[model samples]
Target: MPDLVPPMLPATGELADATDPARWAVEFGWEGHRCVAYVRRGRVRLLSSTARSVTGSFPELAVLAEQAPPGGLVLDGTVVALDEAGRPSRGPLLRRTATLTPDAALRAEVPIGYVVTDLLWCDGRRVLELPYRRRRAELEKLALAGPAILVPPSFGLDEAELVVRTAEQYGLDGLHLKRLDVPYQPGRRTRNWLRVPLRRRRQVLLAGWVPAPGRPDRIAAVLLALPGPEGPRYVGRVGIGAADADARTILAAPSGPPPSAVPDGVAEHARWLAPGLAAAVEHRGRTAAGRLALPSWRGLVPDDERDDDLLDMPAAGGSQGGGPVSPDPVRDTGTRARDEARSRPRADAGAEARSRADAEPRSRAGADVHSRADAGARSRTGTDARSGAGPAGTDAAPVPAAGPEQPGTWHGPLSRRLEQHFVYNTLNTIASLVRTDPPRARELLLGFADLSRAADRAEEPTIRLDEELAAVRAYLQIEGTRFGARLSAEIDDPAAAGVDPGAAVPPLSVLAAVRRGVQEEIEPVPGGGAVHVRLVTDPGGPSCRIEIRPADAVRDPFVLFSVPLDVPEGL
Candidate 1:
C-alpha cells in the first residue's frame, strides 16, 4: 500500500508573545454547526469539528455548490436554524442534523443558513496569508446567491462581546471571539477564539493523582469530581500536580496534621494522606449535562467540617474553602453554619450584615461577574428566594424577578460561569463513569438521572473517586490527542496560613486531570487506575510558582496555565 497520509494537526500554539494586539486580531465568533467546509469542482464536503464527514445530511448546501465562489476553497460557517424570523435557534438545528432528515417543507420553512464568516479559499488563490479583514473581504464577494448560505456579519473585539450579549438575549447561540491575525489553521482549534457564552457551575471533589510518565514531583495534575449521571462524576483533573513549590507545600501538608485519620481507601494507595485533612475545592462550572467545567483548588478548608460537608452544599456545593464569600473557610462558615440556612428570624439583616461586614462584595473585584447587580443575585437563591421562592432544594432556576420563562438563563456572570461549569462537569461525570467503571458506567449514569429528578437535590455522589478518574482520563487523552482541550482555569486559597500542619495547592485531583489529558502514559497504580482532566487558565496574576518534582515523562519545568492563591508563602 502507498504511504498513508498523516492526519492534519487540530491544535496549535503560537509564539509566546500572543498578548500584543498587533499579534492578534479579534472577531465575533458565531454559534452554529462547527464545521470545516470545503468545495472543489462544484462538490461540497461538510465536516464535523472532528473532521468527520456529514455532507449527505446537508444536501441543500450541496445543491447550492454551483454558487460557491468558483474555485477550490474552504470556509468556517454556522449552519444555523432560523425561525420564521431571521433569528437563530442553535439547539434545534443541532438536533435536526444529528438525529433526523430535514424535509423540503421543513427545510424551506425553517431555513438553515450557511453563515460564512471566514474565507479559507479564493477563486484561484489561497487567502491564508491575508489578514482577517482581507480574507473576509474575499468571502463577502463570493457569488453564493443561493437560499442556503449567507455571510454573517463580523466585528472587532470591542463589539464582539456586545454581539455575544445580544445573541444570548435574542435566543441565538453564544458569540465566538477570534484572533484576526492568525493564519487559517486548517483543522486547528486555536485559542484565537474565545466562545463567550453563559452556562452553569458545578463544584466537584478533588481526588488523587496519576503522575505523567517521565516527570517527577512535576505531576500532570489530579482527579476531580461532582455528582453526575453516575454516582460521583469525574469532571477531569488539574494534570500538573504538586510541582509549584507553594502548591506542594500546601497539598502535602493538608494530607496530615498531628495525625490524619487515614481513611481505608486513601491509605490503600497514594503512600500519603493522614485522611481527616479536608480542604475546600472550587470548580468554575457545571452543566445540566453533568460535567465539571473549569476547576482548581481553593486550598485546605479548616479541618473542622468534614470534607463531605464541603461537598454537600444545597447551592454552590463542594466549594466551601476559598469560595464565593471570602473568609477563613473554617472561621467564615462558622458564623453562618448555625444561622439556620432555612429559618432565620432576621435573615435579611443577616444577609446584609454578612454581605457588608465580610466585605465579600456580591462578586470579586476583577471578576467578570462583578458586573452583576447585587440585588439581582444576592436575593437568597434569587429575589424570590428571599420572598420564599421555594425551599433551597426545589428551585432549578431562581432569578431575582420572575421574568419571562427562560429555561437556561442563570442570574449574573458568576451564575452564568457556574452554568458553564455544570455542562463541563456533567460531561466529566459521564467521562468519569466511562473511565472508572466501564461496566458499571450505565448504572452510575442511571443514578444521576434519579438525582436530577429527586427533591433532595442537596444529595451528592457516594463514590470517593480521586484515583479512578485519573486512569480513565488517560485513555481519553490518547483519543483526544487529535483535538486539543485548551483549558484556562484559576484556583485560589485564602487562609493557608491558618492550615494546621500545612497548606495545599491545586490538590491531588488537579494533578490527575493533567496526567489524564496527555493520554499515552498509563501508570500502574497499586489498585485499578482512572482517567481525569482539569482546566487551563489565562495569564497575569499574583501566585507562588508550584512546580512538581522531577517525574518520569513531563519535561517542561512548569506549565503555569493557572493562577492559584491557596499556597502559603514558603514550605
Candidate 2:
C-alpha cells in the first residue's frame, strides 16, 4: 500500500521552463550520466534524456517494470545528482550527481542521482515529438519516482519583479515561467521558460549576525551571503527587532547554515561564523554591502501567521497568497490544518513543527524525490492540481480510482491515487470553520463533491465512504475537517429500525450493528450528555446501524475500527 503512495515527481516549478531550442541537454545534462526511462521486454529501462539507453547505471528504474503502465515505452530524462535535500539543481547537481566508483567529480555528492526529466512513452503514449507543452502535460501526470522526474518548482506572478520581491521577502528563489504552447525538444534548450531569482535566494557563505552595535541586547543583522572568502561582510542590518520573548528565543540559537562543507573560500572567515542564532529572514534583495538586501526576520517574533494555516489562502499558483507551498498540495494543506497553529502562545514551537514537516522526511534511495506517489503520499504541498480543481475553490478534474495496492510506478494510477487522496482529504477535513463556519467548509465541500463525482465516474478506484473519512482526517486534521457518511440513507421499516429486527444475519452483519458493540464504550465528559443511536437501513444491500458515542463520533463506525476485523485493507 505504501508503494501505492505516488512517486515524488518534481513539480513544474523545478525546470528551466525553456521555450527556445538552444538550451537542450546542455544546462541540466551538462555532463554526468544522462538517462531516460522506458519499458523493454516487460522491464523498465533507463535511457539518456537524449534518447540513449543507459539502463545499467540505475538498475532500480528497471525493477519498476511491474508498476509501469501497460505499455512498451521510452522516455528522455536526466539522472540528476541529488543533494542533502534530495532534489538537486543542474548547477548544484553538476557538481554532485556522479558515481563515486571511478569519478569523484561525477559522484560529487551523496545520495547519488534521481531521474527528473522523463519525455517519452508514459501510460503507453508516445509523447516524444509532441510540443513541450503537451508532452509536459502528460509528463506532469506521471507517477512519482521518489525524487525522479523532478518537475522543477515554478512560480507564476503578475510580473517577474513582484516574484523576485516576494522570494526575497520570503527568503526563497524567485520565479520560473514556461510558455503554454512550447513543444518538447529533447537534448535541446529553449527560452520557453524564465527564471528571475532573488539575490538572497541563492546559496551564500554564512558569516555571522551583527549585534545591535553597542546595544548587545539586539541582533541588528545577520551577516550572510558573500561572494568571496571575506565572510560576514555584514549585510545590511534588519531593524525589525523582536519582542522580549522573541529576543530570548532568537538569542539562544545557532548559525552558519546548519553545518555543511563550507565550500572553498568560506573557511577563510569561518572563525567569524558563530554557531547558534538561526535567523528566519525573508530575503528582500541584495544589499550594496555584498549581502542580502533588506531582509526581514520572519520566525523571530511570531505572533499569528495566516499563511501557516489550512484556512489560509491556498490552491495552485496562489499569488495574492503565497506561492506553491511545496510540490504537493497535500503536505501544505496538512501543515495549514495543524491544530496547534495560530493560537500557539509562542512562535518557536509552531515554527519548529512546521519546519520539521517542511525540511525532514528524507526521500529513500531508488526513490524519485519528485515522483507523484512519494510526494503525494507524504504531504500536500498546497499547489493546485493542474487537472483537478484549481486552487480557486472549484471542482476537480475527473480522476481514476486509486488504492494502496496499485503500483506508484506509472503516470495514470499514481495520479489517480493523488487525485483520490486529494478529494478524500478535502472532504473530511473539519474544524470550527467546517462546523461553526459551514459557509467556508460548504464552499470547499462543493469542490470536493465535484471531485468525488468525477473520480467515482472515472475508471479510478472506487472510494469507500470509510476511506474518505480516514483521508480527510489525515489531511484535514491540521486544517479544519469534519466527518459524515450515510447520505441518502433509508431504513426498510422505522419500527424494525429499533433494536432486534428479526432476520437471519450474515456473519459480518455485526459490523453494521456497531451500536450494539464496541462504540457502546465511552462515557460522557464531566457534565456532557450521553451518546445516542441511529440506524439507517439503505434501500440497497448494505444496511447500516450507527451509535453516537463520545469517542466514536463518526456516522460510520468502520472508519474508526474495522468491525468483525475482516474488512479489506485501504477501505
Candidate 3:
C-alpha cells in the first residue's frame, strides 16, 4: 500500500442545461460531514475535510478496518446521522462530530453511517488516474455491504432530474453529476463534477442586530440587508437558524453608527452598525416588499464581499418590506405589534375621538337626519366586521387573505429502496452459491470480507496492481463458481508485454471491467460466456492501460443497456 494523501474535493457548479445521459452519472449530495477514510491492513482512520482525525467520533466505522481486504485502501465518503425516518439529519451529524469523546449512549442515540462515494486507492494501486466510471466499477467490485459503510447508488443522466427531485423529497440536499471519463484530481477544482442544490443560497449584508431584551449583549435577531439602487436596503431580520456562537461572534465585532434612516416597518430599536459584514442566508423566496421570507442564517460570509454583488438579485415579492415601503400594518402582525407598542399614545387619542363621535349619535339630529346617521353608522360597522377589522374607534387594521400555498416537493424513497433491493439480491446470490459449492462459497465470503476490509483502511492510498487484480479475480472466480463452465475469463498479461503486475492501478479497475463485461454481455446470453483482459504499458508514457475484450464483440454492452459505462480502455 502507498502513503495516504488528502482526499479529492468536488468543485461546486450549476448543472448544465442539457447533458448527454451516456456521459454522466449522478449521486445524491448528502447533507453531512465530508470524510476521507484510510484503511491499512485492517486499521481505519477517518479524517475530516481539514485532515483532522475524526476516528474517535464514529466508532462504528472502525468495522471497515476489520472487514478490509488484505491490502490497504482509501475511500472518500460522507458521515451522516440519520433521523427516525432514515433521512440524513445534518443537525445530529454536526452535534455528533463536535463531541470530543463519544459515549455509548450518544453513539446509540445517533448511529452514524458512512456513505462511500469514490475510491482513491485499493490494495497497493493508486486509482486517482483512472476514469470515474472505472473507479466506480472498482468500487462495486469491493461489494460494499454495510451496516456502517455502504456505497451510494448512482443514476444515469436521464434519471438525474428524478434523482434530484427524489433527494429533495427524502430531505436530502441535492444531486452531484460526475463525468464518466474524468479522472480524480485531488484538491483541485474541475468541471468533472457539478453540484445542483435543492435550495437557492445568497450572500447578503449583515448591517445590524436587534438585541435580546434583558440580554443586551445577546441578539434576538440580526438585521440583513442587500445592496439597492440608493444604498443598502433592509431585506429582513433573521433570528432563527443561527446558533448561539454565531450571535456571540456578531456581538464581538466592532460596532459602528446606524444607517442614515431605518427601513419602514423595521423595529426602531434595532442597533445598527457599519455595513461591511456579510451573511449567507437561505429562504424559500422573497416577500412582496423584497424582504426574505423565513430567512435562515447559513453563516457569515467573507468580510471582503461587496454590497454591489447583491444588486442583481431578483426583486422578491411579498408583504415583508425590504426598504422604506412599510409592510401593511394590518397584514404583517409582527410589524404591527412592534409599531403598535411605539404609537400607543397616538392610538389612545384616536380611540377617544372615535368614542366622542359615537356618543354624539342620532338623538342630536332631527328624525330624517337621525335616520341617515343610523344608516351610515350601520354601513361602516358592517363593512368593518366583514373586513376583519377591530372596534371602529381603535387603530386595528384589517386582516389580509391567506396566500396561495406552494406545492410540496417530491421526496423520492429511491435511495433506501435501491439499497434494500441490492442487499436482497446479494443475499439471494450468496444463498445460491452456498447451495452449489460450499467451499467456493466460503472463498467468496472471505473475498467479500477482504473487499470490505480494504474499503475500511485508515491509511495506505495505493495498492499493488497485482493485489487489485487478485481481488478482481476473486470476484470473477465467485461468479465463475456460480455459473460453472458456462462462464470463463482470461488474464492475458504476460512478461513479454512489459506490463508490471506490481505497477499501481486503481483498486478494482481490472475486476470492474471484467465484471461489467460479465454482467452486461456474458450473463445476459442464453448461456454464459468468456471475457479477455489484457494489461499493457504505454510505450513512451508513464501510464498502464487495461484492454478488455468479451467473447462476443457486441456494441459496448454498458452503452446499449444504459448501465454506467465502466470500461478501462482509456486508463
lDDT of 1: 0.38
lDDT of 2 by residue, 82-140 (tens): 22211222444444323323243333223234434445566656565576556655654
Could you tell me the TM-score of candidate 3? 0.40
Q: Per-residue lDDT for 497-552 in model 3, tens only?
A: 55444443333334433444465446666666666554433322222222223344
Candidate 1 on 1-571: residue-level lDDT in tens?
A: 1111111222233223235544443332345676667776678887777667777767777755576555567766667664322244454576568645667765544456576667766666767668765776666566453445655445444333343333332333245555666566554455664554433222234444434457644445555544332233344554433335424532443332211222344334342322322334434233323344455544444333333323332232233323223134322221222223213111111123222312211122223122223423111212322232432334432222111131112223222223222222332344344435544443433332222212112122111121222222332333232232332222223233222112212222222223322221222211212221222122322222212112233322222112122212332
| Candidate 1 deviant stretches above 4 angstroms | 1-11, 14-16, 27-53, 60-74, 77-117, 121-129, 140-289, 293-295, 300-571
After superposition on all CA atoms, what RMSD does each candidate show versus the true structure? 22.7, 20.1, 28.4
Ranking, TM-score, top scorer first: 3, 1, 2
Best by lDDT: 3
Q: Of models 2 and 3, which has the larger lDDT?
A: 3
